[model samples]
Each structure stands twice: as structure tokens, then as C-alpha cells.
Target: MSGERSGDRTERASDLMQLNAMALEETELSLHEDADGRGDPAAAERLHRLADSMTDTARDIADRARNLADPVPERERR
Candidate 1:
């Protein structure tokens, strides 16, 4: 039962990681477009910030997934 629960959690984490990565890619494209003259400087700055936020989110999601997949030692487990 515990193993099944762990498997489910891992799957969920994997899904989240994929979703975040997609979001980061999409945001990066938007940022590039904004810098390519389709958008103003202010708008581009906003897009850049958005992209940075998405990247941070993706990183956080990946980190969480890694932690879920390979948990810390018993003494270090949170």
C-alpha cells in the first residue's frame, strides 16, 4: 500500500515537472518575441520577468520531483 502511494506521488511529481518545463519554454519564446521588436521595451521587460519567474518555477518543480524520486537518507528526510 505504501509503495503504491509512493508510486502515485512520483507520477504526480513527474507530471508537474513536465508541465513546468513546457511553461518555461513557452515563456522563453514569448520573451524572445518581445525582444525581437514585436513588443516595446517595457513590455519586453515584463516578458523577461515572466520568463524568469517561469524558469524559477520549473526549477523548483524539477527539484521537488528529484527529491520525491530519490528521497534523502532517513536522518535527513523531511
Candidate 2:
């Protein structure tokens, strides 16, 4: 997988590896905050949306990383 430092594919994979964990951690924390019920109703709703967005973004990033790490053959790409 190529990163900003494309010379080191291992480094890129290692860096990509962190995204899901960080994203999930943030998602859980956001949901926890919502459950704690400290914020106003509007804020809670927004927080839920934020959590969903985080999850979706994480999945997208992870999918991209996977493709980079294991590139598809040109024939298979079609």
C-alpha cells in the first residue's frame, strides 16, 4: 500500500491499520457521550449523526486501504 511515503509500503499498511481502530474508538466515545445525556437534545441527535458518519468514513478508508494493500489485477478490475 502506498501512503504519503510511498517508498515504504509496510509503513503505509501500518498507518492504514490505525484508521479503523481510531475511528471505532472515536465512534464509541461519541456514542458514550450521547448515552451520558449531558448534551441538549439537538446535540445528542447531531452526535448520533456524527457517529454514523465516522463509521461510514472508517469503512470507506479501510476499503481503500485494502485495495491499495492488495491491488486487483487489471483484468479483475473490470
Question: What TM-score, computed on C-alpha atoms, does each candidate reach?
Answer: 0.65, 0.62
Best by lDDT: 1
Q: After best superposition, candidate 1 residue 65: deviation in angstroms?
A: 0.6
Q: In candidate 2, what are the lDDT values of residues 1-78, reduced to their tens digit?
A: 233566376447846666774768687677857756845777777777777777777767766676667777899978
> How big is the RMSD of model 2?
4.4
Error of 1 at 69 (Å): 0.8
Model 1 segments more than 4 A misplaced: 1-5
lDDT of each: 0.74, 0.69
Top TM-score hit: 1
Worst 10 residues of 1 by lDDT: 31-40
- TM-score of model 2 relative to the true fold? 0.62
lDDT of 1 by residue, 15-38 (tens): 787777777778777777766664
Per candidate, the number of residue pairs that clash is 0, 0
